[model samples]
Target chain A: MRSRTEKTLIYALLIAGTVTFLFPLWWMVAVSLKTPEAAQAATVRGGIASLVPTDPQWHNYPDALMQMGSVRWTGFLDALANSVVVTILATAGTALSSSLVGMAFARMRFRGSRPMFLVMLGTMMLPAQVTMIPLFILFRNLGWIDTFLPLVVPAFFGNAFFIFMYRQFIAQIPEALLEAARLDGQGWFGIWWRVILPLTRPVTAITAVFTFIFTWNDFLAPLIYLQSDDQATLSVALNSFRNQYGGITKVNLLMAASLTTMVPCILLFLAAQKQFIEGLGKGAVKG
Target chain B: MATIELNCVSKTYTGDVRAVREATLAFRDGEFIVLVGPSGCGKSTLLRMIAGLEAISGGTVAIGGRVVNELPPKDRDVAMVFQNYALYPHMTVEKNMAFGLLRRRKHGGISGLLFHRAERRAELAAIDRKVLDTARTLGIEPLLARLPRALSGGQRQRVALGRALVREPQVFLFDEPLSNLDARLRIEMRAEIRELHRRTKASMVYVTHDQEEAMTLADRMVVMKFGVVQQFGTPGECYARPANRFVAGFVGTPVMNFIEGRVDGGAFVAADMRVTLPAARWPRMPAGPATLGVRPDQLRVLYRADAGASSTAADGASVAATVRSIERLGDRMDVAVMIGGTRMTARIENDDRLVEGGSVLVHIGLGAAHLFASGEDGARLGDAHDAG
Candidate 1:
């Protein structure tokens, strides 16, 4: 009797929490389908009406894509393409280089290897802002300023955190496997390619997903490096969209654009959700 | 097949931690040598050094009369079967066996790329044939398409063995390859490995802590302790004439028993009784405290009409002991007897109806007895054969 009441109360609290967390996403979607005036009016309703607009403004998506006048070339499509190219290249570079560097650190036995790994780990502790100025100067001297090189080239060098994560994952692989490969006449590079890479698919997926999300959502680097409207990524273009149209009338288009920008990340997470969770769990335990 | 020779090989980890001490040994062509010892005895380390899987800190390891201390494991012309089998989980059994062959060729950069695809395909087909042939030989042809995780422990072990065998290397190194299998499977695999060795005639070094396995499989056995080689000899020689107390205790099933006593007036004097030394041993026997080592089978147990009669015998050759326990092992029984303050086991025929707490006359086979100097390092003074 009393347990029944307690269960009811617990379920009620859970439902309330779920609604509270999901309300923003629900409102964003609903408002994206509303006209500017209706969205502004729905926000005043403060309840169900705000979460579900009465008459959906389906033209807001097409309008946001075409009417974002500050964008160059084919407007939002060009920005999306730019974002895709940069994110894919940068993510690929990060995944490949991080895994190779990680395998070397975890398996190779060279003098100063330990200290060098420690230094690499120490770089993770240092904030990206600390190296931001120096990196800018270096890129500028290389004549790579106002180009995608500044955003994508650094990824090829490897990320300290991802390398550390990959190293931990690779370290958990039995040393016997490496020894077996060596006895099978595989050099270090061959072992890394043929043996280690195939076995680390889950970890590579985790790295790729995280790198894709990071590069896709990153606004600061794109803001600094991408100067022309033509080279601007979706993130930079979206930020510029907010700045250029900071009026109440353009709110619906902004919400629609934001929703469009987040769909790929959301879809990717959902697609690789199983591997992502498994990789995270494995990393937490082994690392 | 090749003769592998290790000359004063040693392994010292960072901070001067010695895993394998300066040890010298050699494996002749087509010989099955087993390195048997307890864990941390450096047997595995020694085998790895020979395989070129480990860096030799000091001396040289020569394979096929060529020094390979600086060579990588791939270049050493040797294959190793690890304790855990170490099968590539991502690969099927056929691919696992063919992997070594595929990587054996060294292709140069640009010029290699031109003809690489055609050559690689031909080589791969040849490797596949070799893999299938080896699989057929091991009776694992059906399992060739299966991944390692899908196979049973024994099947995986067979695949691991197949992988090593497919290489046809100069030497084969097995580091406790059967340690993971069940008792029955281990026994079956033992015979399989021995038969394989006979057929291939490849020089092999097998490592295991199981003395029984070592005794049955080895043409010659190395008994080690504390990273040192205590004895290296044939099984019969090691069991009959051990180099030290350690070797004697390590090589046998029911361990050799050691009783502390003093050598006085051509007799071994203990607190409870005295043992008369054989006439031949007395000439060389030094007058000092010593340990009398005897195997369970070497001690003779005699039924006594009166329990106290042997205890008070004038000659004092036999000791009176009370039967503490009996482990009946089919045709034989291990009878634990309490002789004075010391407890020793005696292996006798199960025909006798011996009960606990019953007194008996225990005679030490002096002709087969082993004597060692009584100290921390119990160096062997003489063996039973010394009597002659």
Candidate 2:
């Protein structure tokens, strides 16, 4: 009987915590539907009561959309396109390049390999901001400023962390596999392409997902690199909407756009959540 | 059918750790030669060198009378079954067996028209037939469609064996292939491999740490220590007459017992035990001190010293000792007897009456005792008994 009471109390606390966590999302949607006055009232009251608009103004979405851009459904639509392109390209480039580099580092032996690997690992700790300005200047000199080139091309070389992850994952594969392939009259390239690549799907998928998410949600890079109104990413465009609209901002349209930007990332995570979690758990064993 | 020869092959690592010293061995066509030793004994290293997996640091490895030291593993035409079986986990058994053939066909290495679809299908069908036949031969026909993960340990091992056999390579290299199985499974696999060898009669070089596997399988076993070949001979020769103390201690199950003793008037004397030596040649010595190597099976534990000698038991030579421990292993009991501050183990039949802490006279069969020179370099001073 006491255990039943304890279970009930535990469930009650869990439900309360969940509601508390979800309250922000509910408020965002509620205010998005309400007029600016109702939003202010909601902010003031900080409860569900203020969510009901004194006078619902649905035109706020069109106004916010027009102010951002008419290129698509909303300003968020253009930003979504930009995010999709960058994320897909970055994920593909990072996954392929990192896996290649990782395979070499993990399996191949060459002259000065130890020192070279050390230098590669050493690049991980160096901050990205340290090289940010220099990279911008280099790209500017190369006539790449105010363009997506600044955001996309450099990722083809791969980041050190992803490469490190791939290396650790690939190293766990038995060397005997490669030996067997060799005895089957396979060249080094044959072994790498046919055996290693085929066996490394899990690691590749995890790396691709992480790279996609990182590229998708990145606001700072787009903010610094993209300048034009048309070229601006969804993240930068959202920030610009807040700047231009000020107190008269459409809560619904802004919330809608913000929510839309998060959809792809959430969907991707849902699709590969099992593989991602399993990969992480496997990595934890090694760690 | 290939005769492989290793001419003074040596493998030394960058850290100056020599995994295989200057070792020269040759295997005749269709002979099963086993490389047997403890861990870190360079048997695996030597096998790898022969397979072209390891770079030959010093000398040449000739496969089928062709120098192959510089060739890659693919060109060596040697199929090796790894200790862990090394079956490709992602591939089914059929695909695993057909991989080498498919690779060969694609590369035009195996004379066939690559663009002819019907001909390719025929070739694929031929490969399938071969795979099925090999699997059937190994009694793993039902496992052809199964992945490695779904198969039992013995089944996976058979697949590995089938994979090697399917290629029909010039030589087969087995690196501790049956070490992963349980005792019963190991015995079964050992018999299967032995029968397979008899059927195919392919030149094979097997590496294993199990002495029984080595003795039972190989036409000749090469015993190694510290990257050097200690002895290479038939099982009977190695067991009946080990060249040195290391080989003597390494081959037997319980290992041979060594009692530190000194030679005195054609007999060896330790603290309170003495054993008369048979007629044999001895090394040039001052007759001061020596060590007697006796196998456990040679030492007989008896409750009474004057029991009627059985035909299997040697005629005389018995010594008294207090029983230290008795381990009954069903058919036989391994009895460790304490004699004069040194414990010597004896394998007696299970029917023998013996108990721990009870004093029993152990018959030291002089016919099988080996004597070595005392000191750091325990050279084979002489065999106490002559097999001739």
Candidate 3:
């Protein structure tokens, strides 16, 4: 009986916490449906009235899309397309390159492998901002500025954090399995492709989802490298939209555009939530 | 079908960790040889060297008369079943068994590409047939479609065995394959493995720490310690005539007992006990300190009064002892007896209801005694046939 009451109390607390966390999201959607005048007027009422608009203006979506006029290619749709392409390619490159490097580090024995892996992990500790200016100069010298190359090409080399995650997951596989595969006539690459890859689906999903989200939301690199409107990603394009229309009358359009930019990330998290939590929890615990 | 020869093979890790010393061994064609030892004794390391999973540091390993030290595992044409039954977790039993054949190439380059589709299909069908036949032999036909995680320990072990058998390689190496099974299942699988060896007549090398498994399954047993082969012979020969004191103690259940003593005037003497040695039987007997080894089953325990009369009348040696403990094992009783501050176990028929602290006499079977030199190595002194 005591346990039952405790369970009820815990569930009640969890529900209240969920409401507290989700209230802002609910308010964002509600305000996006309100006209600019109504949104401004509702803010005076405070609390619940401030959250829910008196009249829902569904036309605000198209109006917001149009008000942010298309540059040569900086229109909302084109920017969304650029984000999707960059994210998909970068995510694929990161997963493939990171898992391969991680497998070599985890399973192979070589003269300098231990020191090399340690150096690779050390890179994760250095702040990305430390390398920002040098990287910009290097890409500029390579004639890769104002192109997607600066944003996507580096992922093919590998990411230290994702490589570390893959190494942790791959190292847990039984050595006997590798030996068995060897006896069954598999070479190193064959074992990696067939045996190691299939078993590491959870870690791969986690890496891919994380890379997608990171690349999709990354504004700083795109802002620095992409000078033309045609190459601007969603994050940079959205910021440009805000700068162009900073008046009080355009607040509803801003809210609508912000909500549009966040939908893909939210859907991705929902789709792969279980794998994400499992991969992160297991990697830390095992390491 | 193949003879495996290891010519002074050795394995040394970095930091000078010698896992296997210069070990020379030869396994005959179609023979079942078991490498039995305690943990860290290099039995598994030796097997891996033969399977090409481990590098041979000092010597050459030849399978079917070809030196395999430089060859990769696939080119070596050997299969190994690991202790954990390392089945591919993602594949079904059928695919697991057929994996090796699918990966192998029958022809190379342009010729291979010309007939690739037809040859590949034929190879797949042949692999399926071989896998099905092996699964049938192991009685796992119904489980061919299921993954390894769904199977029980015994079933998984059978599938692992089938995986090795499906390849039909020249040599089969098993590294403690049944160590993970329950007691009853271990015994059951032991018989199946021996039967499989008999049917296949393939040269097999098995490694285990279980002496019973070694004794029952091996045509010849290699007893090792500290990366060195102490003795290699038939199980009966090793049991009857161990090369050193280590083998004598390692290869038996209810281990052999040792008593330190000195030889004086053609008689062995300890603290308060003496046994007259027959001069005619042991002609080269040196007069010095020695160790006497006796199996538990060779010592007969009798009641105090009967022991007193038998000692005076008997032609064998007998010692007065007090029973320290009595363990009734259904058909047999193992009685721990103390003789002159030394403890020794005597296996007797359970018909006698002996109790703890009871007075008894332990008769040493004169012909069953083993004499070892009283030194650090404790080398055997007489021919094993003399023990009879």
Candidate 4:
């Protein structure tokens, strides 16, 4: 009974700590909606701040949306579209390619397969900053600058960390399924496609969610490759809005755009929560 | 059906751990052969080699008159049932059974033609019918709509069997398929598999460490140890006359007892006891101590008072033993007797009237006794040598 109470207390303390850590993000959203007057008033009042505006200025949203360009809402729409395309393509590419390659690394037999897998694993420790200049040069040569291709095409091959994660997930599958497939006239490719691919759904869903969120929220990659304002993702576009609007920024519109950017990922999580939790459990148990 | 011939087949790992030594055996078409051994004895490895799941490191594996060492498992035309019953968890039983045929049809049955939906669907439907029929045969029809996770272990095992039977392959390989079941389920499944084999008339190669399963199911048994074939013959041949000490010690329940003694004037003598042997049909005596083997059922227990005083003459064949304990197993009783400071068990039919620490007379069946040469190599020294 004492240990149970202790456990409950530990869980409560952990939830308190998590809320504490999340306060900054909550404060950012809360403060973004307030006018300068309201924000200062809330700060002066100290505990229990209000997110709503007493004198609501709904025009601040359109003003913030148009601040980066002559047109009012086109900039937000274009940036949103660019972010969606890059995220979808990158997530799909990473999930498909990395999973296939990871299955091979986990189960298949061939000369130098181990060494190749090791090399991929070795890349995980490498600092991306070291390769940024070379990647930029290569993209320039390929005429991929100012395009989303530079940001998404590399995912088709796979990231080392994702490949490692996929390989770990695939390794937990029993070898009996593969053998059973073989007896059923299934060749190597057949076993992979029919047996392994179907069994890895949880891991695939988890990988897709993480990939989508990561690519959607990334700022550095877009800032480097996307040279044109029209090609800018939401992050870069948000920066451009802040630059144009100056000190009296339309905080309400910025919060609306941020909230808009976050909604898809949140919806994805809600839709796949069961599989995502199962994937996390599977991964934990495997290691 | 196919005849599998393993010629000098061996498998050695990189660290010189020999999983299978130069083991040679042959399986006749439609025969049920069992590879029985202790744990880590490489019985499963030999079966995998026949199924082309394991590579033959030394010799050739010929199946149906073709050398299959170069062939992959898919092309080997043999099916295997694993101990774990590796059903695809995501697939329903029906879909799992049809997956193989659908794949084969998609690949033009390995000719690599363009995928045709019509032909694939027809093949899958045919396979589904066969799977459903086999599931019914295995008494698992109710589980066809369920995923593997929803089925019990026994039901999952039947699904695995159904999947294998749907292929109608030439050879069936079983790798300790009943080891995972409870005692009752194991017995039930064993009987079902035996019946299935009799009906299908397919050549089967079963691997297991359970002696009872091997004895009951195998037409011929191959006893293995340390990756070497210790003995190979009919179960009766193995039980009645073992090739060596290992086979004799390994194949029986409660095991045959071995006692050290020396032959003296056609009678084996140990300490204060001596028993006459069937000396006329045996090998020339080796000039050293020898070991005597007697099965528990072959040893008879008699109380000292039960044997009349007149029978205690100078025959030298009777021994005085102290009864250590009596185990009444409902239909039979196993009495443990301490003879010359060594415990020997005698299995009797409902002889529960014996008491512990009481003196008794143990009579050895002279004709049923087995003698082995007492050397570093314990070879059976009897007429069975000629049989071997």
Q: How good is the docking of model 4, as DockQ?
A: 0.54
Among all windows of 10 consecutive residues in model 3 chain A, the one with the lowest summed lDDT is A278-287
Could you tell me which 10 consecutive residues in candidate 1 chain B have the lowest summed lDDT?
Answer: B308-317
DockQ for all candidate structures vs. native: 0.55, 0.37, 0.49, 0.54
lDDT of 3 by residue, B292-379 (tens): 8889998888775654432422335788888999888999988999988999988889846577987778887756677778864587
At residue B69, candidate 1 shows an lDDT of 91
Task: In model 3, state the lDDT of residue B145.
Answer: 99
Better of 1 and 2 by lDDT: 1
lDDT per residue as tens, model 1, A100-201: 999999898889999999999999889889988998899889999888999898899999998998898888888898899999988888999999888887
- TM-score, cand. 3: 0.91
Q: RMSD for all candidates, in order, please.
A: 3.3, 4.8, 3.3, 3.9
Q: What is the TM-score of chain A in candidate 1?
A: 0.89
Question: Mind giving the per-residue lDDT tens digits that candidate 3 earns over A1-287?
Answer: 56988999999999999999998888878878887777766555546766766678888877776655365323777788888999999999999999999999989998999899999989988999999989999999999999999889999999998898889888898899999999988999989888988888888888889899999999898899988776778887766545545744566777787788888998998998988787767743110
For residues B1-388, write the lDDT of model 4, one tens digit per residue: 9998999999987798899999888889999999999999999999998988888899999999899999988888888899998788888988877666565565355344345656655766677788788878888888789988888888888888887887788899999998999999999999999999999999999999999899999999999998999899999989878877788888887788778888777667787566655545564564568888888888778766854221222222557788998888899888888887778888988764678988888876655667777753377886634655
Candidate 1: how large is its RMSD? Answer: 3.3
TM-score of chain A of each: 0.89, 0.82, 0.88, 0.85
lDDT of each: 0.85, 0.81, 0.85, 0.81
Per-residue lDDT tens digits for candidate 2, residues A206-255, read: 98788888888888888888887777777777775464547535556676
Candidate 1 lDDT by residue in tens digits, B6-97? 88888988898788877888878999999999999999989998888888899888999999998989998999999998999999988999
TM-score of 4: 0.89
Output the lDDT of residue B382, model 1: 66
Give the docking tier of candidate 1.
medium
